[model samples]
Target chain A: MTHKRVLSLTLNGKNRQDLVPDNMLLVEYLREVTGNTGTKQGCDGGECGACTVLIDGEPHLSCITLAATVEGRKIETIESLAVNGRMSALQRAFHEKLGTQCGYCTPGMIMASEALLRTEKKPSKDTIRTALGGNICRCTGYVKIIEAVETAAEEVAS
Target chain B: MTEVLPEFRVVRPATAQEAAAAHRDNEGARYLAGGTDLIPNVRRGIGDPDLLIDLGGIADLKKIEVGANGARIGAGVTLAHLAKNAQIAAAYPAVITAAKSIAGPGHRAAGTVGGNVCLDTRCVFYNQSQWWRESNNFCLKYKGDTCHVAPKSTYCHAAYSGDLAPVLLVMGAQVEVTGPEGSRTIALPDLYGEDGQNYLALKRGEFVTAVLLPKDVLPTVYEKMRVRGAIDFPLAGVAVALRRDGDKIGDLKVAVTGTNSRPFIVEGIEELVGGPLSDEVLDKIGDLVQKQVSPMRTTLVAPFGRRRIAAALARRQASALFAG
Candidate 1:
C-alpha cells in the first residue's frame, strides 16, 4: 500500500505543495521533488549540520525533520538567504573571510549563522561558535567561518 | 544474504488514539518521534520494523503547559525547546541544564525529550553494525544469549546514557504512556529496569505521551560528565535535589545515570538530610553513590573512567544543591 501524504510548505518565498511518502525526509523532498539540491546531505543522521535550514527563522536540521511535519510551515534554505542576486552581508563576509573551502558545509553554516544573526545583531564570538557547533567543516578548521560571522555582525551593525 | 536494506511503510497519524490504533494494526511496527535515535538504528539495520508510525504530527504530544496542578511536558517537545523554555528554565533549571547538554543545538532541536527518556538502552556490541556484530558472533543485547561485555552474565550491560533520565528521576517525574490497552502513569524511576536490553518496563505497544513533573519538591541541579563539552552522552551524570530547614539539610535525593543499565536513586542519602552538607558529608554520599553504580565499557568511554566520573558528578551536584 502506498503511504503518500500531502505536504503544504512555503519554501524560500514560494508556496508549494507535494504528495510524498510518509517517511520522506524534508531534505530528500527538497532535493528530489522541489529540485533544490543546494542543501547538501552529509550525514543523514543529525550529527553533521549539512542539512541545516531555517524553520520559522530558527535553525533546524532538515534531514531529520519529516516532510509531512513541515506542513503549513515556512522554511528558508541557503538559496533564500541571498536577496535578488545580491549576497547578504553575511554571505559577503563569508567570501571575504574565506568561510568555506570544500563548500559541503556552506549551506548549513550560512543558515545557522543567519538564524543567530536574526536574533542577535551583534553576537559574541561564543554565541556564533555555539550556533555553528552543529555544523562540521573538515576544511579551513572553522577559523575563517568564525571570523566571517564576526565580520558579518560588524558589517550589519555598520 | 543480499545487502538490500529492508524498506517499510510509514504511517502518520494526527492524534494519539489514531497512532495507537496504527500501532496495534501493524506488526513489527514502532512509533517514531524525533528519529534522533530511531533513524540511526534503522540505518544500522538494528531496527527492522515493517512499519514506522510517525507521531511527530500528533497534536497532543507537542504541548508544553504549566497549570495549577503542575507542568505537563508533551513527549514530542524537543530538547532545545525545553532548554530554552522560560518557565522550564525557571522552575526546573536542572532539566534545562540537562537538556542543553544532551547534544548540540541541531540535535537538541530534533531530539525530543520523550525520545531521550525512552531512548533504547545501548551496548557497544548491540549498537554496532550488523556486519560488525557478525564478526564478533553477536551479543546478549541483540539476538545472541552471550553477553560480550560480561560473557557469563545472563543480561545485557548496555548503559543508560540519556541526559534527561537522571534529572527527571531526581525531580520525581512521572510518565503517562498511552498504549493499545489504555493509559498509565509510571513513576520515572519505575519506567526503567536494570536489565540493559529489556530496560523499559512499559507495556508492549505503549508509547509515552507526556511527562509529569511534580511541583515544589526542592532545588535541584543536574551534573553530567563527558570528555567533550557537547554531543557526547554523559559518561556519568548526577541529579541532586536538596531541601534545607534552617541550617540543617531537610531532604536529599541523588539520582545517577550513564553508569548502569538504568538510573538509580542513591539510597542512604535520606539519612544525610538532618546533617550538615560538609565536604566530608558530601564525600561520604559520593562514596555511597560510587558503590551503587556499576558502569560498563559499553558506550563511548571506558568503564573505570565512567565510574570515577559518577562520584565526581555526585559531589558536584550535591554542592550545587547545597549552594542554593
Candidate 2:
C-alpha cells in the first residue's frame, strides 16, 4: 500500500491535521478520524447527500470526496452550523418547523440549504425544494424542511 | 468481515506531471477525479483498481476560461461551477441547462464535468453490489460471457448516462487529454469507441484535461427525457445546434445521448438542408432520426419510448434552434 500522507485542513474554523490513506473518503475521515460524526454516510455512494459538507463555502458530497484532496482547504461540517453553543438561525428554524424525522439527512439538507441561503438570502419554496432535491429525505415528506428554510430566511430577514 | 478486503496504495499527486508519473509507476492504478462515478463503482466493487491516484489535488486542472474562441472548461471544474458560470450560461446555454439538470446541489457541487464525460457505461445488471452480482452470475460487461441487456447479443448494452456529453457534442466541442507523452486534442465525437466496454479512446494513464468549444458557433438547444426533472440521468437526450441563414438551416449538428454505446451524431439528417423546414420536412427528419437511433431496453425508460422521444426531441430542438 502507498504510504499515508498528512492532510492539514481548517475544519469548522479549527486547524487540524490527520494521516489519511488515499482511499479514505472525506466523509469517513470526518466521522471516523476527526470525530465529527455529523457528516453521516447514508449511501456510501454519491447518490445520497447525507454526507454533505461545505468546502470553501460550497456544498459538496463528502462520501465521494477523497480526504487527501481537501488538504489545506476550509471544511465546514454540520457541527459548525452553530456558534458559541447557540444554534444557527437555520437550525432553530428547522427545529421550530419540525423539519426532521429520522434525522439521518438533516446535516446534508441543512448544509445545502445553508449554501443556498448564503447566496440568495431569500429563496422561493420551489427554489428551496430544488436546492435540497439532491438530499433525499424518506421521512417527513420535506414539507417542513422547505418551511424551515423559508422560516429561517424570514428570521434572518427580520 | 471474515476475509480482509484487498487494500492498495493511494497516491495524491499535486501536479499533472506528478499525477502522470504516479499513474505510470503502478500497474493497477486509476486517476480519481470528482468520484461522482468512480467512488460509487468502487464501493459496488466494480473494477476496483488497486491504486487510486487522486487527481483532485492538481490545481491546474480546475480552470474555466472564456477566450475569444468560445470557452475552455477544465476537467476538474465541478458541475455546479459549470451550471453557474456566466460565460457558459450566455455562450453555451444548452450546456449550462444540461449541467444544471444533472443532480441536486450537493452532488453537482462535487461532480466534475470530466467525471461526467468519463462516466462508466451503466447497466442495471452491472451497477449492483458484488454480493448481488454473485447471486445473478454477472453479465458481459464485468463477468460472464452473455449480455444481460440482450441475451442473444454479443456485446454489452450499457446506456450512455452523461447529460452534458450530448450538449457539448452538439456544440462541436473538442476534448484535450494529457498523459505521459503529451497532450492532444480531438473532437468529442472521436473520443468514444463503438463498443460500450471500450467506449473511451483515452490511453492508459491519460487524463482528460479540458473541453474546448468552437468559436462563434450556432446557438444550440438540448432536450432530455427522464423520470424526474432533476437528479436523473437522461432516458434520452437530444441536442441540436444549428446555424440559420435567413430561414434556411445552414449548418446542423445533432447528437443524441442515453442511447446505444456512445452518443451518436445524426449525420444522416443533412438531406433536408436548404429546403423549407416545413411541418412535413420536420416530420421526415424525425422519422429519419428514429430509424437511425438504436436505443435499447437497458435505459430506465422503455426502449421504444426512448426512440420515439429522441425523434420528438430532435424535431423540437431543431425547430427551436433554427427558427427565428
Note the clash tally of each candidate.
0, 1
Number of the predicted model whose lDDT against the real structure is largest: 1
Per-residue lDDT tens digits for candidate 2, residues A1-158, read 55588889999999998887766779879998989998888877767688889999998988877777778899999999897999999999988899988899999999999999999888999899788888888785589999999999999998
Write down the lDDT that model 2 would get.
0.83
- TM-score of the A chain in candidate 2: the value is 0.96
**lDDT against true structure, model 1:** 0.84
The CAPRI class of candidate 1 is acceptable
True contacts kept of each: 0.41, 0.63
C-alpha lDDT of residue B193 in model 2: 67
- Chain A TM-score of model 1 versus the true structure? 0.96
Q: Which runs in model 2 stand beyond 4 Å of their true positions? A: A1-3, B1-6
